[model samples]
Target: MKQREYYFDNAKFLLIFFVVFGHFIQSFIKESNSIYALYKVIYTFHMPAFILISGFFAKGIYQQGYIQKYAKKLILPYIIFQLIYSVFYYFLYGKSTFNVEPLNPHWSLWFLISLFFWNMMLLLFAKIKPVFGLVIALLLGLSVGFVDWTTSYLSLTRTFVFFPLFLIGFYMKKEHFIWIRTKKARLTAITTFIIVFIGFYHAPSINYQWLFGSKSYSSLAEDPFQAIFIRLFFYVLSCMMIYCFFACVPNKQYFFTKLGKNTLYVYLLHGFIVRIFRVSDMTDLVNPPKSFILIIAVSFLLTLLLSSSMITSLAQPIIELKITKLQQLQKKWSNLFQGYKAKLFE
Candidate 1:
């Protein structure tokens, strides 16, 4: 088996941590300017960087059964989670009626459906020259905003809006990432992050929803035509922030590095905890400044917990449609039990 690169793994773990942290602080964005700025800063890159990395690994599109493979991997889990979240929200919100609109993905589930689409898109987009493909993708992404109907239903908006990054990632070679890891790039990345954060802190009028890429220009601005420029600006900003994020990711492996492979588990499972936290009075307790430190710690711990073998083992069936991890975990416990029994008998 080929060895996994620690650099990508490190990048994934860090990005997923940011994803969790971003979701945790979202409830408090309205109450704290600093948190709001941080939220904007995070949203600018987290998902885009993730999508780019996802694209980077998508070089296997030509392999046999690739489409079928991802369909089972992404679509199956998306369906399962869509139903789960629907039922979860039904009970959590105590709604008058139960509704399951698979078209409308709940919260963070959009990534699954959109990811599948991005891979499918590579069938066509990958055929074009990289530059032309990217330009076409950008134009399509910008044009889609005018068609007000291109909302989040089936994640169509984001599928197009973010496809350029995905295409860019697909075209990227290993050497490109190696170049970003240079000391000069790291310094530039740190400076970029600081400047962006400060800029966001001062520019409260810049709506964070622009970073979401979910809404249409019609809804977000007075003039749809002008909003295209705003969306273009964000596309540029997101790409810059994405490379900056990549530049900062350490290439060395760490304790949490292996957990990066299980990010799907974290992405799918963390929602339950975050949703419950959002609805509960817990948000009131996690006020900004000092409390945010606690939120950060909790986010890291939550990411760690969800990525642990035990959680992955339990969730393997639903998420991966496999029990290999579960069986290993079961055998591990059985061995421990047998060892304890032998000790007692002795």
Candidate 2:
């Protein structure tokens, strides 16, 4: 068996925690700008980093037959959870009747749809040179800013905007992450993260729609040229912070390692729980300091609980349909062979 790169697992654990934390903070987004600022900074690099890491691990999918299994792994859960959340939304918030429209994502579940596309597309991109793929992804990202139909449906804009990060990850070798392990690099990453946080805190209220890559440049009321530059800047900055994040994350085996393995479950299931809060108005923070501390703590705890093995074990039947189907098929074949053998002997 191959050794597990604890570093990647560790990174996934951290990113998933932030995903839950960020969603939790959305409840308080209207109440506190400071928390919103923190949320903005977290949003800036978290998904990009996650997608990049996904690309890294997704290396050689074409050769490895990984793509063949993605439908069962990603697509099924995406459909199941999308419908589940749709119903959850309809009843909880009284939106409409349960509806499952193609290409239209339900809230945080958009990542699954986006991931499905990226995984499938990477097979085509993998045939090209790394530099060429990177260029293509960057250009597509830039051009996506000009198109108005890039937002929402299927998360096309985000898929294109974040495609470069995924490409970069695909091309990165194991040695690329070596620098992050050094003491000097760790110090710099910490410093950079702190400085960025400080900037986020004092930064004026700015539209963060660009970071999500879901907005059209025209919609933002910026000229095409300026929008291109802004997108380029964010792309570079996000890459920097992604590297810094890899540097700062501990490379050792930790308790969260297992949680990292089951992130799909956490990512898919936690949304329902979070939605319950969103509809119940439980996330609203009335008292700033008191609510902030309590909510953060609860959110962190809830994230961990959702990612726990207990929850994963329960969800396995739903999320691991391929495994279940394979088991049933195996049993059916075994029974058939037994009957044939018995009849032949008789």
Candidate 3:
């Protein structure tokens, strides 16, 4: 078997951590300016970088059964989680009625649907020259904002809005990542991050929703035509931040690096804990400065916990539609029992 690259694995772990951290701090965005700015900064690159990495690994589209493979991987879990989240929200909010709409993904579940669409889209997009294809993707992203109906339903908005990043990743080579890992590049990345954070902090008038790419230009502004330029600006900002993020990611393995392999588990499972926290009285207890520290700690611990073998073992069936982890645990326990039994006999 081919060895996995530590660089990408490290990148995945870090990005997923940011994803968790971003979600946890979202409830407090209105309570603190620092949190709001930080939220905007995180949103600018976290998902886009994640999508780029996914696109980088999507070179296997030509392999047999690729479509079928991702369908089972992405679509199946999306369906399961959609239904589960619906039931979760009904009780969490104490709603008058229960409703489950598979078409409209709930919260972070949009990534799964959008990811699948990105891959399917490669069938056509990949055929065009990379430069032309990217231009087309960008144009579609900008144009989609005009069609008010192109909202989150089916994740259509994001599918187009973010496809350029995905396409860029698809065209990237390992040498490109290697080039960014130089000492000079790393320093520049650090500087870029600081400048971006400070910019967001001072620019409070900028609608953070622009970073989400979920809403239409019409809803975001009275003049929908002008909003297109705003969306274009974000696309540029997100891409710049994404490069800085990639340049700074360490190419070495760490204890948490293995957790990267199970990001899907964290992505799907962390929502339950995050959602419960959001609705509970716990959020009110948090205060600024200190709240930032507390939120980071909670987010880190949550990422670690969800990525643990115990949690993954339990969630594997629903998320991966496989009992492999559970079976491995069972076999491990059986061997341990057999060892003790033989000892007693001896």
Instruction: Please tell me which predicted candidate would have the highest TM-score against the true structure.
Output: 1
Q: Which 10 successive residues of model 3 have the least lDDT summed?
A: 1-10
Query: Tens digits of per-residue lDDT for model 1 on 1-346?
Result: 1233888888999999999999999998889888999999999999999999999999999899999999999999999999999999999999989999999999999999999999999998888998899999999999888877768689899889999989999999999998888899999999999999999999988999889888888778648888888898999899999989999999887899889889999999999999999999877777687797799999999999999999999999998889999999999999999999999999
Regions more than 4 Å wrong, model 1: 1-4, 339-346
What C-alpha lDDT values do all the predictions have?
Answer: 0.92, 0.79, 0.90
> Sorted on TM-score, highest at the top, how do the candidates line up?
1, 3, 2
The candidate scoring highest on lDDT is: 1
| Decoy 2 TM-score against native | 0.88
The list of candidate 2 runs beyond 4 A from truth reads: 1-4, 322-346
What does each candidate score in C-alpha RMSD? 1.5, 7.0, 1.7
lDDT per residue (tens digit) for residues 38-126 in model 3:
89999999999999999999999978999999999999999999999999999999999999999999999999999999999999988
What TM-score does model 3 achieve against the real structure?
0.96
The count of backbone overlaps in candidate 2 is 1
